[model samples]
Every structure is written in structure tokens, then in C-alpha cells.
Target: MGIRTKLKRNRTQKKGMPPGSLVYIGDEQTEEVTVSAIAFDSHGMEEFEDVSIDKIKTLIDSDQVAWINVNGVHNVQLVDQISKKLGLHPLTTEDILNTDHRPKIDFFEDHLLSIVKMLDLSAESTDLDIEQVSFILMENTVVTFQEKRGDLFDPVRLQLQESKGRIRKSGADFLYYSLLDVIFDQYLIIMDEMDDRIAELEGMIMEDPDNHSLQDINQYKNTILQLKKTVWPVREVVNKLINRKVPYIKEDISFYLQDIHDHIVQANDMVETSRGQLYGLLDVYYSSLSMKMNEIMKVLTIVSTIFIPLTFIAGIYGMNFTNMPELSWDWSYPAVWIVMIIITGLMLVYFKRKNWF
Candidate 1:
């Protein structure tokens, strides 16, 4: 299913149903679920794949930190079993399936659930593609759920692979910070993409604003609106997490979270500025089209104005009055021609003086 269809389905499925219904309201994917686990401490690391839920639990029961990433959450049964095993709230499981959620953080007694929207431009069509990513932070476990596998977290994984950073030494809270850092870092990429698109539109507007410019502006405006829906609330999520004052989340990671918050604010500002640019572009597009129409109308009006008196002069001569003296005179035709030429010349001079052209 398409993203728009997923959105409609989310709304439709909720109707006539009780609140907190667990429905997988998103794009249907037949992709097999892939679970990758990595347990690492300062000493070393253990990474594996296809680990069962019970095995993950056994791994979590150990002293080392376990990072189990579950890619493809469309399998409702698997998600339910995993959530049940992790003691996740039913609403949290619903949120995991329902991927239209804004960036938010919900706290529980034993664990913390943080939900965020991941953004990407579709390579095939240049359309914005959005996905929801949920993170569960427990004592020794950090479980990440993605609707589909994405390389956005590759850098974090690479850090683990190279043993180049403190990730190997970090606890579950630090892992949470690292994963969130990766997620919010994507906003920078998204903002840059928006900037490039806005610049392209500006060039088009300045060079050749046409009917399509309005259409493109409207499309971009809608894109910005959708982006604002994701980026702005992220600021709240960042701020709340930064000031959460929870025991599970470490104070030393506060600086890193603060940096993420700053980046989120920057992303929000860019969205607002870009939205303003879009509105301004819309106005400019209308003004450009109006000027174009005015130019055409001006030329037509000038032609009609020049013909009005000429029509009247021809009409006067066209009259078939029986007693008209000029009709019988030999020079009457030439004389009428001279009079019309003079009238036309005077009218041209008047138009020139008024700068009607």
C-alpha cells in the first residue's frame, strides 16, 4: 500500500473501534523480519542475527548490553510477541504498528519508549517517504523497531564494527542516545534536500514563472506542511527527553542530547523559513501570471482603441443619405481619406504623450 493509503487506513480502522486497538495501520509489506543482535561491552562485542525473542531475553539477562534491532514490523504476531516479552505497553505496541506518529517520548516505570519519524526522498519519484522508528530503552537492552531496514543507522553500526568509539563501552542509555542521535541527524540531510529543492524552485520562478510554477509551488507547500508535521513536534520530543530527569537516562549523555536538541531546533527553523519562502513564491507566481495577462490585455486594448474612431469615420461615410453633398463631389473621397489620416495621427500623438504603449 502507498503512504496516502496507509494514512487513510489508519483513520478508517479507528472508526467504530474502541480506543487503543492494536492495528497494523501502515503500508503492507511481505518482507521477512530480520533481527540483528549485538551485545557489546568495553571488553568486546557479540553480534548475531535471527535471534528468537526468548534468546534475546536470555541475552538481555546477561551482564553485557544487548542491542536488538528488528527490521520490518508489519508482522503483527511477531511484534505482539516481542512487545509482550519486553513488557511494552499495549498502546506502545499499537504505536509500533501505526507508523504515522509524530516524534514523541513516553516514559514507563521500567522502560522508556521513544517514537520518531524518519524521512527520506523516494529515489524513484522524488516524493517524500516517511517511516516511523520506535526505540525501547531498558536496563541492559535497547530494542529498535523499523518498518523496514534502512541504512540511517549504519554509522552507529560501523562504530560498533570498528570498535572506534565508546559504543562498545556504553550502556543501554548511551545506546539510546546514540540511536536517537542517528535519527535526528537524518533531519540535517532532509533539511539540506529541502534547501536544494527550494533553490531550484526559486531559479524557475525567476527565469520562467508559468502555470506549472503555481502547481510546483503548491506541491512544495504541501511538502513543507507535511515536513512541519514531523519536524516541529520533534523539538518538543527533544526538549522533553533532555529534561526528562529519569534514572535510566544518564546525565553525562545530556550534552549529546543537548546537541541533538539544537540540531532539531535548527531543522524546525529551516522548515519555518522554507515555508515562508513557499508562501512568498506563491504570491510571486500569482503576480507574475497577472503581469503576463496584463501585457496581453494591454496589446488587445491598444488595437481596439486605435480602431474605435476609425470605425466611426467609416460608419459616417458608409451612410447612404440621398441629400449628402460630399457624396457627389469629385474630391470627397480623397478629402475623407486626408481627414481620417489626420485624426489617426493626432490620436497616435495623444497616445504617445500618455505613454499608453
Candidate 2:
């Protein structure tokens, strides 16, 4: 089963609910809250430690670029407070709480709202763990929300800290792009691993077809199908962002979004390729099994052929009614042995000549 079905979201809001309604969209268990802020402009950058909600407002109004990263989304009160302060719409808030949503981008009056699934492949089992991350991008500020704190944004943070690229000079839109780029890059890595696994399984199936190998191939096919469900929608989401004009997206940065769109295309292509490879694997498995069965039948037929005449000779000797001329002869036992040996040798030679063994 896909993770979406297993980790489905429960709606807490009523129908016709007003905008900005507070609802929690994560697991029931709550944990400690952690907030980190990075405020940067063309000239310099500052990292704030242990910042409170009140302190966040101070940076939101500044002309300098700012990025507010909230690690935990379990606190409804904190999430509500941030929504109220920033004047975010209720629908946007609802999406943040509804973590089961596919990747999407929505345009608001002053910001562009983007939602994406972050994937982590288990090193031990090669299974996938998916999480949802939401982004709210404005002109000078960007806010990111995740279910828990981990390495999802570590690459983006490193880029900011080292000023490795033009991240420091870029606006919040570029920061938004950076975060998405990192997430999609992870997807590529996971796809590569999946490709390797499929290739290995293909080799095993060709070498030996067994019940275990068939089961493994089916499991891999299921995994790839589930992954396709997530990736296809994401491609459409990015495509919408690239073609549609939104206030938050600058004209200059449209190309960057287009680049992300291209990555989505690449991911989709890999998914299709994986599907084809799996089908080819199934074909190979069936053919190998058929070949093995034919070999076993051939050996059984040869054994049965060699035993038929020997069984007949024994039967004739056992039916002693004194009327059997050969049984009455003085050298009958030795002659019967010689005849049996000759028959067996002839059958063996014929089988060898026919290439049946």
C-alpha cells in the first residue's frame, strides 16, 4: 500500500468553514517547539537564535530578506499565531495542516504558496518514507513548515551559511527555489537507487527463477507504482507554477521554476523507464521458469525409457510356468544377462546420439 493511504489526513474543520481556521494536520503526538530564522540582504546576513513569535514580527517588516523555518507543526496555537500575524488565508492554513495533499502551488494576493512531498528511502529495506513540507514565499521573506526537524533543509542552510552560490544576493523567491531544488534533488537520488535495485533483480531473475525471486519482483513493482503516484502529480504542480504568472514569482525567476519543471519531467521519465524494466523482468522470469521445467521433463523421459525394457525382461522371467523355453535352457540365465546388457547399451547410445541427455 502507498503511504498516502496508510498516513491519511483527518479533517477537523467543518464544511463552509471560514478562512484562517485553526486545525492541526500532523500526528497526534506533540513535541517541543523549535524556531530558527535567517535574515539576509545584499550586504550582510544574521542568524537569530531562540527567537520568539514576537521577535519574528520585527524581522517580517524589515527591508532585508528573511527566512523563517519552523521545525515542528504540532502546536496549533503557535501555527495559528503565525498565520494571524502574517495575514495568511485560511485555505493556505488548511493545506499546511492537511499533510496528505499532493505537491501543489497556489497563488495568493501577496505570496505564492507551494506544497511538496519530501522522500527518504530506508537504507536497510529500500522502502520510502514521505513527509510534506509547505512554503509561503513573499517578496522579502519566506516561511517554511515541516512536520519535524531533520536534514530536509540542511543543504539550503549550508548554501546560505557558506554563500556558496548567489543565494545571499537573491530574494526570497530564490530561497524558495533553493529549498525546492534540494528536495527534488533528493528525489533524483532515490530514483537512482531504485534503478540499481531493479537492475540487480533483473540479473537474479535471469540467472535463477524461483518463488522468492518472483515475490521480490512483485514487491518492487508495487513500490515503483506507488512512487509514480506521488511523482506524477508533482510534475503537474511544478508545471502550473512555471506557466502561470503569480505576484510572488518574479519574471527573472520564472526560468528557475522552469528548470525545476524540467527536473520533474526527468523524474517522470525515470518512473516510466522503471515500469518498463519491471515488465521486462517479469517476462524473463516466466521464460526462465519454462526452460527449467522443460529440462526436468526431458530427464524424466530418458529415465522412463531406459527402465521399460528391463522391467519387461524381469517380468518374463518371473512368470515361470515350465512352458518357457528360455527358462528351461542350461545357459538361460547368462544369455538373459547378456541380452539385457546389449539392450541397455543400445538405448544409451541412441539417447546420446539424439542429444536427449
Candidate 3:
């Protein structure tokens, strides 16, 4: 879901449902579920789109590393069918169908099930687009289920197609690491974008702090929080892999998985730093507003002070009193005007020397 879209966990609908119920708990998805498979050995590679279940099974049994990518898991029947065919545990299937699942790793007897959040920053704004993705690691095959079509795995696919990297020569666990490596790299990319945004916000606050800037700062705080929540659990997932908790993940592949852990740690640190900076920005924003108010009040007070004596003089003359001696003199009015001008000039000089305005 994009940041602008309100997130809702639809598990309430499953309140009375059975424990192993196949319910979709995310945004409404109407798109058709599509499957793609990539089978490759060190010698060659083949790609299939809209592949059948039987074809996927064949590739899984072949002497190669098979990657089956299933997009759009909203269809409960289709997901149940695919899970049953692949022999995924019912609990794993339940987690896969629940898009609200946090980033976690579950070890099963035959397969290693991992859930993670895929994050992408929208191009139009700082809003983040997040989706839950699940990966099942088997002996010779790695199956990835996504909430929808499109992913950050294009580069991995390209490398596999061209046989341009060590991925082709590696096992299924290595391929799983390669896919996760893409996600970790994406985390960094999003972090870099956020860093740029923080700098931009700092500049904006310094130059012209306003309500909109405050709003943006608050929005970023929420985004950073979400990022932190997602990245931390992923760190744990990689830590488990590094500790050799999943038997299907080879030892050498575990070494590569350490890189993912390091990346997650770095990303989490960046998130923490950004969060602090945003809070600092909020303080600066309020301070700027206060200073502006002080300046405005200072100007008004000076104007009112300058007019105080003038108003008093006017008020005295405005009184209707024929008994006053100065009212009978011809030059009294001119004399009063001169006296008032002199008083105003003297007051101005005193204020200038005091530097009160």
C-alpha cells in the first residue's frame, strides 16, 4: 500500500474463521494471478511466463535451480491450490495469505518460509509503497509469492538470463540470497532518497518555515517509523540465516546472507538518524514561528509607544473647556504644535540611541 492510502488489516473478517482458513487480508486485488518460472544451471537457462503448475513441478525436479514467481495472492483458492501442490505447510500458507504479516522467518521440516516487506518510494512524492512478500526455500527450488505484479528482481532475472554472474553457478539458496540482496539494496536506495529529503526539508525550514513544512516533517517521521519497523525484523531474519537456522541455506550462502544483515543494520541506523533529525526540524519549525511572532509584536509595541504621548496631547486638547487660559491665545495652537513636534523629535532621538526599534 502507498503511504497516502490508509492501511487496514482485514483480519477481523477472519474472526470466526478457522485457524487454517485461506483468507486474503490486504487491499482488494482484482488482477489475475500470474506465474513465471526461471530454471537455470551453470550451463544454460530458460524462462517461462504464465507457466503451468505441471511445468513448474517439472522444473523443480530437473537438474537446475528453479525460481517460481507467483504474483497476486488475493485469490484464496488459487493460493491454496499452489500451496498444496508445492507441499507448503498450512501455517506457512496462512502467513502468505495474510499480507499484514511482519518480516519474519519460519523454519519447517521440509522448507524454510520467510516473510518480508518490499518497499518502494513513489516517484511523485515521499510516500512509500509497501507490499508483503513471502519466500519458500526448498532443496533445489525457491518460490517467491508477491502481493502483486512487478518487483525489484528484474536485475537478478537479467543476470540469470545472461549468465553474467555467479548466481547461475550457485544453488537455490544462493538464488534466494540474490533475491533478498535486491531488497536490501532497495532499502539503501530508499534511505538515500530519504536522506536527500531530510536535507531538503532542513533547507526549507531554514529559509521559510511554514505550516506545510511542519506537515512534511510529521509525514516523514511516520515514514521513518514504518521503515524502521520493517527493517528491524528483516535484520532478525538475516541473523537467523547467518546462524544456520535454515538447513536449506548452504554454508557459503550464509556468508552472503551476512551482507544482507549488515545492510539492514545500516538502514536501521540511518532510519534512527533521520528520526532524530526530523524531531530537531520540528523544534526549529516552532522556534522560527515564535521568532516571527516576537518580531511582529515588537513592531506593534514600538508603534504604540511612539503614539502614546501624541494621543495624550490630542486627548487634552480635545476636551471642551472655555476656562483654560491657553485657549484664548492666538499663538497657543501654533505653540502647542511646535511643542508636540519637539517632543516627538526628542522621543525619536532617545529611542534611536536606545536602539529599541
Candidate 4:
């Protein structure tokens, strides 16, 4: 669905309803909600795929770091049950189901909540894909919810399997930080792709600017706009993670979170730079178009200027006056032809000297 339409629908659904009520506000894609769990420590990791809600609830404990991933939030009952089991506040679950929320960080007594937009490029086309990902970081467990099954978290899972980096030895808050790192990495990926496309567009428009070029410029401009809107809130979320001084997060992870915040700032800078370049592209396209039009108009005006005096000469000879001396002479036709040629040549020379073409 279009962004505006989806937002409008979500707002309409919440009207007159009690605050914190469970209402799925995103596109519903699954026949059944899917839940999965993973528990890991410094030693090893174990995964439970498509596990039942009851099983997932049991997986949350103090022994190891547990990552509970809920793929679909359309099932309100399932989400409510999970929230109740996890001791999450009503507003927390409410935000999880409401996928239209802006990127935000909410800290409660027991858990911290983070909401952010994850971006992806569709493999089939240039279309951009945006998904709302929510995270709840507790003492020994982390709960995540997505609009659908596919996500950018696979790399983190691979790291967990291979025991790469410090992730194998961290707590739930560290795991949360790692996941946010991956999300910001995806933003960089998107930024690189867009930068490449913009460079290609610059070359194309420079070589030949036309309607098609203008349309492509507009398309990239819109994509940059989407990037700007999506990334603006992320700075707030990351800044909160660093400055809010949540008690559960270890101080060591602050450096890591700061790096993520810097990456987010870099991504935002790229977006702003791309936006300015796109605006310059529009100016270039207009200048090229105007140049082409002036060339055409110059040629037409020169042709008309050459024809004016020739037409006047012809008009004088065609008159029916009885005292017309030139019409009776045998050399009149050749003389008139020579005069017209002279006028045409003179005008051509003048146009060339004026550099009208």
C-alpha cells in the first residue's frame, strides 16, 4: 500500500478505541503467526524454529541470552499472550503492533524498547522496501518483532553460529546493540547503491538530457526523499541509546553504540548530499532543455528573416498595374531570381556571424 493510505488506515482503526489496545496496524501477510527462539552464551547456540507460543514463552529465562523473534504481528491474540508472559507494558505491545510508528526509544523499569525502520531494495526492481522492526531488551532476553519473516538479521545469526566477534560473550543488551549495528550497516548499503545510481544518472544526463533523463532524475529524487525521512528518526533513537543512560545496558557497549550513531550520521550526510545533487541535476536538465529550444527557435527566425524581403519582391511583380516597367522586361525574371538569391545569402551570412545556431 502507499504510505499515506497505510497511515490513514492505521489512524482510522484507532479512533474511539481505548489506548494501549492490541490492534495490528500493518499489512497482514501470514495465515498463522510464526514464533522462534534462540538461546546462546559464550559456549554455544541453539535455535528453535516455528516453535509454539508456549514454547517461546518458556525459552525466556536467566541461564543464557534468549532472542525471541516474532515474524508477524497481525495476530493480536498471540502478541497479547506473549506480552503478558514477558511482563511488557500495554503501551509497549501497542507500539509493536502499530507498525506506522516513528523510530523511538522507550525505557521502562524492566525493559527498553527501540523502534526503527529497516530498508531493503527489492531484487526484482528499483523499488525500495521499508519495514518497521521493534526490539525489547530485557535482562537476559531480547524480543523482536517484524512485519514479515525476511530480515537483515541473518548476518547476526551467522555470527552467532560461527561465534564471531564479542557477540558470543555478551548479554541481551549487547545482542541488541549488535543487531542495531547490522541495521545501520544496511543503511550504508542503501547509501552506496544510491550513490552509484546518482553517479550513473549524472553521466547519462551530461551525455544527453531528455524527458527520460528528467523522469529518472525525479525518480532518484523521490528515493532520496524517502531515505531522508527514514533516516532522520534513527539519529534520535541512537542518541537516546547513548544519552538516556539506561541501567540495563553495560557501559562498555557505549563505544559500540557511539560507532553506530556515527554511521547513522554518515548515512544521513550522504542523503543530504544526494538531495543537493539531485536538485542541481534538475537545474542542469532545465538548462539543457532551454538550450535545445533556443537553437530550434533561432533557426526558424533566421529562415523567416531570409524569406521576408524575397516575398516583398515577389509581391511587387505580381501586381496588375499597367505602368509596371519591370514586369514587361525579358530580364525581369532572372533579375528577380538573382535579387532573391542575394538576399538569402546575405541573411545566411548574417546568421552565421551572429552565431544564432
Candidate 5:
């Protein structure tokens, strides 16, 4: 899912680059940025592919609703130009370039900016993958940037194109909410995947505890911890948005943000639940080891009990030959064998009655 961290500042660009240059926030070998402009209103929708910054500028003035989606963050100049055209703050642009930002909301004089993480589970390995997505909401337009070319926003795009919901009639803030909702939905999917894995590990531990299962549980526990680190901050960010009266955010959209807040709470709850399950699994593993030790001890104790009487008879016979009468008896060897068998049998019976096995 194109997981990325904060990019190093490109100090080398100082040779000719402007002071507020848009420094790419990720891997430099990224593909060219792909821009798609979707202009929609109550009446209809129009989509423009591979649109240039000039075209975007022209569309920004249109009364129809517009969404500009940029697929890559590698072209600093283009991003800088867009920021200038939209009157976005330089700090906001810098945050956009700093990919390590936690989920947050910033209220600018003319717009609202949101930073969020998108999660995906690796298909080959059950690893949780994440990417950073930044949203800039203006009067009638919403601009979104991603660290990579692929995303989970296809469903939202389809909805907008089909005019399937209130998205078409709503302002850019609603559109922002829709995008956030999709990202949160992806979070839920990730949580479900983790939950399924936790359940599977539980079954495996219960059936037979082993080192492999312990490692698997620990790996998943670490993944859950990482997810919690990303999501818990998101809850606080959303809470801040919900509590404050932001100018760009519409009052009607507060309820939607509240819903997102509730989802964050649920995500936090799932993390806690997964943590408890991991602890339980560790306890079960230890208990299994203890039980195995007890079984081995039981067998050794039984063998010692059976040999005790036999050892006593042998000790008596080994005394000075002149004093040992049984050693000279004609049937002495057979009598010793019989006595040993009787003692072993009685011990076995006692053990069976006591249900030690």
C-alpha cells in the first residue's frame, strides 16, 4: 500500500529553487503526478483526465463543484504553483511535504486542511500497510494528495460520479468528510483482518501451544500497537474538530465528523481487545508448559514407586552370605520374582484407583 515516512529536506535544491519551493515529501523515484479534475453540480458531472495546472486554474473559477486529485507528490514545482494559486499557507504546504504527520486538522483563514492515514493489509503477508493522505478544502473545491498512485478512494469516486448520495449537493467540506469516511472504512477493514488473525491464533494456541504460535501472536500484537499509535492520535484530532467551531467546516457536517469520532473510539476499543487476547495467549502458553512438566514428573514418580520394594529385597539378600537364609532356599529366586510382581501390581492398582493417570 505504498507505506512511507518523512522525507529528508532537499538542501541541494537551494541553488536555484525558490524560498517556498514545494519539496517532494517522499521517495524521489516516484512516478509522474497524475491529476484528475472532476467537476460536478446538482445537474451533471464532468471528468477531465491528465489535466494541467492551467486547466485546474480555469476550472477553479467555475461555479460547478470541483475535486482535484493529485496522485503523486514528487513534483515540487507543480505543487508550489498550485499552493500559490489556491492561496494555501506555506506551513500547510510544508506539512504536506512532511509525510510523517499524524492525523490532524488545521484551520486556515480561507480553508481547512486534514492529514490522515490510509491502511491496507498485505496480501502475501498478513502485515498492516499504511500511507499518508492530505486533504485541502477550499470554497467549492477539494484538493487531495497521496504519497503513491493507488488508493482506497475509488468507491468515493464512483459515488460522486453516479450522484449516488448527498455528496453532489453538499459543499467541499462534505466531500472532505466523504474522503475521510472512506479512509476510516479502510481502518475498519484492517481491524477486521487483525481480529480474524487473533481468532485463528487463539484456536492454534488452544489446540497446541508452540514457539511458532507465540511468535505469530507477538508479531500481530506489534502490528496492533502500530495501528493504535496511528489511530489514537486521529481520535484526538477528530475530537478537536468536533469540539471547535471552525469557519470553513459547515455546522451540518459536524454530525458526520461526530460519526468519524465514534469510529475512532471503536477502533481504539478493538486495539485494547486485541491486547488482552495477546496476554491471554501468553498465559495459555505458559500453562501448557507447566502441564507438560507435571506429566513427566508423574511418570518418573510411578517408576520409583514400583522399584522401591524390589530394591529392599535385593538389599537384604546382599547381606553377609552366612546370615542370608533365603539366598540358599531352593525356591528363593522364584519367590523373589513373585513378590516383586505382587508389589508392582498393587502399586499399579492403587495408582489407577487414585486416577493419577
Candidate 6:
């Protein structure tokens, strides 16, 4: 379904409900919710393909840092169950279920909640694939909730598996930073794609500006607007994280979050640049239309001006008066033909000199 229709239906479903109500406000899905976890510390790492509530509680209470990933959030009962077990706030659960929530950070007493939009450009086209991803960070555990199964976090997972860099030795906060970093990296990729698309549109506009170009420009404008909306708030979220807004985030993790902050700022700049270019392209398209119109009008005016004198000459000679002198001359027809030819040639030369066509 289209986003607008889904939003309208989402509102209708939640109209009379109280705040913090858990309502699944996204596309309809019947896939069962699946939970997977990876727990690691300096000693060793463990993977859980299917984790239960007891397993989660055990990992959270133990010394090892745990990362629990939930694939689907459409199951309200499953979400509430996990949230209650993890001591997540009611509003956090509500936001998780409401996939339309903006990218933001919510601080609670026990855990910190972060909601971010994950976007990817489809391989087949420039259209974006977007989903809401929510994170709940606690002392030694980070829980992630997604609308569906696939995501861009595979790189982060690979790092954890290979014991690469400082991820294995760091706390849950560092892992959280790694995930956010992955999201921002995708943003950079998207920026590149946007640049390529703008260049393509620019070339099309310059070569052959048509109604299709206008329509494509408009569609891309909306796409870039959505990108801006998703990216702009993420910068604020990263800033808040860097400013020590969340207690769970440690001092060392702040430095890494700064990198994400820089990346997001760069993404924001790219978004703004794309927006300006799209506006300029729109102006070019309009100017092209106007120039075409002016060419047509100029040609019609020149043709009419040349025909005026020829028509007047013909009218004068074809008068019904019997005293017309040209009618009695034997060479009148040839003389008139030569005069008309000379007038046509002179008019053509004059127009050529004026560069009217």
C-alpha cells in the first residue's frame, strides 16, 4: 500500500486508543516473529538462532554482552512479551509497533530507545527501499527491532563474528555505535546514487527536455525530500548521543559516535545539494519550453509578414475596374511574376540577415 493510505489507516486504528498503545501501523504481514541473538565478551562468543524469554534474561543477567535481533514487529503479543522481559518502556514498545515514527531518541529510566529509518536503493531502479529500525540499549545488551527480515547490519554482524577491531572487547554501547555506523554508511551510498541520478537527469534535460523529463524531475524531488527528512533528524540523534544524553553510552563510545555524526552531516549536505540541483533543473525545463514556444511564434510572425505584401499586390492588380492599366498590357502577367519573385527573394535575404529563423 502507499504510505499515505497506510498512515490514514494507522490513524484510524489508533484514534480512540490511549497513549502508549501498541498498534501495528505498517504493511500487512503474516510472517512469524523470529528472534536471533549473539552474545560475546573478552572470553568467548555465543550465537543463538532461536532465543526464548528465559534465554534473553539469562544472557542479560550474565557477564557476556548480548545483542538480540527481532525480525518482525507485527506481532503485538510477542513485542509486549519481549519488552516486558527487557524492562523497556511502554512508549518504547508503542513506537516499535508504530513503524511510521520519525527518527528520534527517547531516554527512559532503565533503557534508551532510538528509532531510525533504514533506506536502501533497489538494484533494479532508483526507487528507495525504506523501513523503520528501533534500538533499545541497556547496560550490557542491545535489542534491535525491525519491520521485516533483511537489513544492512550484516557487516556489523561479520565484525562481531571475526573478532575484528575493538568490537569484541568493547561494551554494548560500542556495538550500538557500530550498528548506527552501518546505517550511516548506507546513507553515504545513497548520496552517491543521488548524485548519479541528478547527473543523468541533467544530461536528459540538456539533450531533450520533454514532458517525461519534467515528470521524472518531480518524482526525484519527492524522493530527495524523503531522504532529507530521514537524514536531517539522524544528525540530531547523533549529536544528542555525543553530548552524553544517554547514560548507557560510555565516554569511549562518544568518540565513535562522533564519526557517525560527521557522516550524517555529510549526508545532509549532499541532500541539500541534490535539492538545489533539482530546483535548477526545473527552471531549465521551463526555460526550454518557453524557448520552443518563442521559436514557433517567431517563425509564424515572419511568414505572415512576408505574405502581407504579396497579398496586397495581388488585390491591387485583380481589381474589377475596366480602366486598370496592367490588364491591357500583353506582358503584364510576366511582369507581375518577375516582381513577385524579386519581392520573395528580397524578403528571404532580409530575414536571413536579421537571423529571425
Q: Could you say which candidate leads in lDDT?
A: 6
- Estimated TM-score for each candidate: 0.83, 0.89, 0.91, 0.90, 0.84, 0.89
Q: Model 5: how far is 96 from its true place, Å?
A: 1.0
Which residue pairs show backbone clashes in model 1?
none
Model 4: CA > 4 A from native: 1-3, 122-126, 202-217, 320-335
What would the TM-score be for candidate 1 when compared with the true structure?
0.83
In model 5, which runs have C-alpha deviations exceeding 4 angstroms?
1-29, 307-341
Question: Across residues 257-289, which tens digit of lDDT does each residue of candidate 1 receive?
Answer: 899999899888988899999888888777777
Candidate 5: pairs in clash? none
List the RMSD of every prediction in angstroms. 3.5, 2.8, 2.7, 2.5, 3.9, 2.6
lDDT tens digits, residue span 1-357, model 2: 343333444353334566656676556545776888999876778999777888789888998888998877778788777876777887788778777777888887888788888888887765777778889888788988888878578888888888878898888889998888888888788899999998988888888889998898888888788689878889878888888887767899888888888888888899899989999988999999999899999999888898899899989899877778887789999998899999999999999998988
Worst 10 residues of 4 by lDDT: 53-62
Instruction: Indicate the residue-level lDDT of 176 in model 3.
Output: 90
Query: What does candidate 5's lDDT look like per residue over 27-68, in tens digits?
Result: 555478789889988888899999887888887888887899
How many steric overlaps does candidate 4 have?
0
Q: Sort by lDDT, best first: what order?
A: 6, 4, 3, 1, 2, 5
How much lDDT does each candidate structure score? 0.84, 0.83, 0.86, 0.87, 0.81, 0.89
Predicted candidate 6 versus true structure: per-residue lDDT over 127-172, tens digit per residue: 8888999999998999999999999999988888999899999999
Instruction: Pull out the clashing pairs in model 6.
Output: none
Per-residue alpha-carbon lDDT of model 4 for 1-357, expressed as tens digits? 565687678779889999897788876465667888889999999998887767766677548889999888888898899988888889999999988788898988888889999899755445788899999998889999988878899999999999998898999888999889988999999888888888888888777788899888888888888888899889988998898776779899899999999999999999998899999989888887888788788878888888889999888887879998887899989999998998898888877898875
- By TM-score, who's the top model here? 3
